[model samples]
Target: MIDRADFLARFGGVFEHSPFIAERALDVGAVALPLTAAGVHAALVAVFRKASEAEQLGVLRAHPDLAGRLAIAGELTEDSRNEQAGAGLDRLSPAEHARFTELNTAYTEKFGFPFIIAVKGLTKDDILAAFEARIGNTATAEFETAKTQVERIALLRLTAALPGE
Candidate 1:
């Protein structure tokens, strides 16, 4: 029930948590020695204080496996982009599954990370097609692509967390 003005004033600079959430997260992170879920909630509450639901999901949507096209190889992992995209296309209609299977293997071989994308709104075929198209991209190109995807995810999470945001 904290006011937006008060919350924003206290914490307004963060790369990850947006302005308000980041500040509270920092405060809670600074002193969670008591170790309670409430402490965690306090930190998260700051994130949600002024955000929309989509923004909140943005932070969690990131794909951890994709590498930054321009990022050091060291930064690459198994899941880099926001893994979620459109929701509920699990039972891919035959050809869709095959495409995903091929793309998944090819992408993993090329970049060493799962081709990640937000799948909340897209179909499995679409996600697989992106992977296929991206498989043809150069490492540097893919790295930048992944970075952009990550930013999108973060923004989504941020918007969701803000109270009236």
Candidate 2:
């Protein structure tokens, strides 16, 4: 177990980029760290390590569906997630919602994965706009964007849950 103080320290290593993530994530990781960043190098290494090709593709598909609900748990606060879910593409005004649904479905079909954006601080309109813009990308391009976005989300979650990066 990491000492409380030490675990909080490691969380920094996870999300070396982006302040928006910093805002959305709670500091519970700081207080709960020894248990949170519990695996030492293995955990951090898992974030950076290579995986089988299938696993790599799975990673691309791992994000929550754009209009799908966020996963609930005691480990994470429900309020924050409710806020995230409220930010869903389906909740937009009719025209914008239609646009978002069209883009989300098409993006999924073309990429074989849900479209992901951090969506933490973004408005519903902003997220839909991003989705529309991204769908124009080729499969190779969209894949990389999704991969990058997920890494950012993982880093954000890690920063919120672990200590000492």
Candidate 3:
């Protein structure tokens, strides 16, 4: 078991820059002291579900573009950096980096936010393929799709942060 402060401190970065999810979960008693990743995720989802569309969009936008500016500038959150590296985003050849930049620009220009995917098990090719496929989706559909991907990312991060998985 842990205190609220400890819980927030540990899991604050789980949702990129959205620590309010943790705080809200605690306030609603959705998170028990000795948290399981699933419980925490559910609580965060509950909060997300109740949020206004604008708020949800803000959360989605909070996430960095994969291998985008933040990564190049060394400004990504530790979790994001590690996740990108895990998917081989950190070691992209020159052509690969340019392709990612192009796709990222196109996706953001189209949807008004970064293209997101939970890259835990995916390769660079997989991420690129997803970017290609998802860019064709309508804005409404892409908004929903991005939110779903954020949930998947939160779950993966929560699981990794849990004491025993």
Candidate 4:
């Protein structure tokens, strides 16, 4: 079995800035030997899903706005930075940036959290379209959608961290 600290050190950030998911997974005996990316992701997601609504909202709120201030200021976590950059979010023109900013603000105002997506395979335009489409969803629908996106992001991160598993 991997040491608890070591496992946390490697997998903690799989859930954006929330290391508590990994910690809670370990507490619940989910970090068994012969760990695979899928297994670890499943365990962490279970804990995340089981979290209180307030705690889940905290996790969603922890996410940085896409191509927003954090990206402009170079403050996103490494995984988020790379993911956004991969989607061409780092090279937005001023008009594009303005639109993203507007949408981010509106989305946050409506949903009480930053827009979240698994950007690994999406283009900037695709993200914007999704942002616009999702903005019209009901608060209850958006909350569940954001949680599912968070899970997708975590799984992608885990796969990258544990390639070949």
* lDDT for each residue of candidate 2 in 1-165, tens digit (9 for 90 to 100): 445344434443343232222222323222323444334333443443344545556655544555543432323224235435656643556676566667767888888988877666678878877887888999888877876776656545654554644
Per-model CA lDDT versus the true structure: 0.48, 0.55, 0.89, 0.93
Name the better of 1 and 3 by lDDT: 3
Model 3, TM vs. native: 0.94
Per-residue lDDT of 23-67 in model 1, one digit per residue for the tens? Answer: 555555532433233443445554454456456444423333322
| Model 4 lowest lDDT segment of ten | 156-165
Best by lDDT: 4
**Candidate whose TM-score is highest:** 4
For TM-score, candidate 1 versus 2, the one ahead is 2
lDDT of 3 by residue, 118-142 (tens): 9999999999999999999999999
TM-score per candidate: 0.46, 0.59, 0.94, 0.97
> Which stretch of 10 consecutive residues in model 1 shows the poorest summed lDDT?
76-85
Per-residue error at 73 for model 4, in Å? 0.8
**Consecutive 10-residue window with the lowest summed lDDT within model 3:** 156-165
